[model samples]
Target: MNQKHLLACHERILPYIHRTPVLTSRWINERAGTEVFFKCENFQRGGAYKARGATNAVLQLTDTQKKNGVVTHSSGNFAQALSIAAKNVGAKAFIVMPLTAPKVKKDAVKAYGGNIIECEPTLKAREAMAEKIVREKEATFIHPSNDEQVIMGQGTACMELLEERPGLSAILIPVGGGGLAAGTSLAAYFFGTHCEVWGAEPFSVDDAYRSFKSGKIESNASTETIADGLRTQLGDRSFPIMKKYMKGIIRVEEAEIVETMRFVWERMKIIIEPSSAVALAAVFREKDKFRNKHIGVIISGGNVDLNNLPF
Candidate 1:
């Protein structure tokens, strides 16, 4: 997408979403040897930056489409985001969640007025259920991170971040389906004076990392990471943009992810989920490369289950 498209989306969704805070920690900076700015999207509506995309996607629909409603599959943040966005736009939302999804996320989705449909915990199962809802109820399907509108919407977060910190040398965003990463790259290209976009992924679910190296989409054989929000593979729509604009992907160990998660909660005094912390973990993994630079870390979400924290 172009800057004009992103600007239009920013304007359209401004009244609906939050301009989440840009935060920093002296301790973190000292440790990482860089001026790290955390885009605290955890404070965003529906408690994640996914709200930005979800709202934008729903708001971009036609009246007839809105009347028909929307459908999507997400185990956590996106489910709540779509539900809330649909509610704001006076449309119905059909959420297909894997049965293995955390109870806290499932409850949040229901609380946000999403019509929950539980299915087997597989990508195929989730997509099939969403399609079934679309066929039976005539709801429009909104892929969490693959739609063009959704990518433009997701880019708004990076746009805001760059607007607030134009001199940033680089940006680190957690990669799952590559929507946020691809969107951030567009924002950096259009808005930043001299900024690069990078993605942070769990080593256990390093499909994006593998994809970047292999020059094609890649899949993880197993989802065995604590960064549950990042288990999904990159999408074809976002993959091309990512390959073109993203500098690289940094893969961090599971221990590093958990440690960074705890560090943010304790030091920053914010409850960042494992997915968000993955960016910080990745940053710390290559401190020498980032030394003295201004880095923006997009804290993607804070939708963790307190009852089962990895720390």
Candidate 2:
């Protein structure tokens, strides 16, 4: 909510999460006609920035609450993040994963010591099962992107980015549930000088973009995007923050997402998932607008299953 709140979150989670590096590529700079700094959250703990929020949430739990543990329904990164964070904080994690979720993600959650609760591949079903577990075990439920503490914690990544590069003209991030976008916008508002914040999302799942324009939450008619991590819609807590601070939302095609993922993997020699590529693809979709500007992109995560490459 404020710089102090974000800084406190950073201080709390600093020892638990990674201060991921910011990297640049001359080729990418020329291609976009902008000096871009990519905050590589892909190299973060649990392979994503989700670790920040999950760890912060876990660490904030009361002693009794920690005894009861925490529960969440996530298809991928957040599941792994909560599992690892809870394990690190000496608490149990109950992860309700959809049956259709990729095997690699499920395996990662298990590796982190999460109790996997398989549910039907629907948001309603996932939430229902998570609630069931919470009721039976008296555990706390943590929404992946909706909790205030989670939002404040997620802002740390952008806080670090802006601290490392104070000259950035703008910051861009992929918007799935709007947590990262909202948090980044807050960081830019509190840290950067004259910096703008933008949200990038896939056209197939442009609910966040439409919600931004309509001033209300919107649900996607289809969930066919290859950005598996972005299939979820924005939450109420993150939506209002995004509306208040975000400059605009940019929608990119599925092909553009795939191409951007390939570009980062082949050109930058770094692995990035489709959801992470959405921000870069949106920048490429509107290169002239950012020409000669110093921009920052949040590479949200890099937990791809190599056997299922989109290319």
CA RMSD per model (angstroms): 0.7, 0.7
lDDT of 2 by residue, 1-311 (tens): 79899988899999988899999999899999999999999999999999998988899999988899999999989999999989987889999999999999999999999999999988889988988999999999999999998888889999999989999999999998877888898999999999999999999999998998899999998889999888999998999999988899999999999999999998899999999999999999999889999999999999999999999
| Alpha-carbon shift of residue 70 in model 1 (angstroms) | 0.6
Minimum summed lDDT over a 10-residue window in model 1 is located at 189-198
lDDT of each: 0.93, 0.93
Per-residue lDDT value at 231 in model 1: 93
| Count of clashes, each model | 0, 0
Name every residue pair that clashes in candidate 1: none
Which ranges in model 2 have alpha carbons more than 4 Å from their true place? none
TM-score of 2: 0.99
Reference-based TM-score of each model: 0.99, 0.99
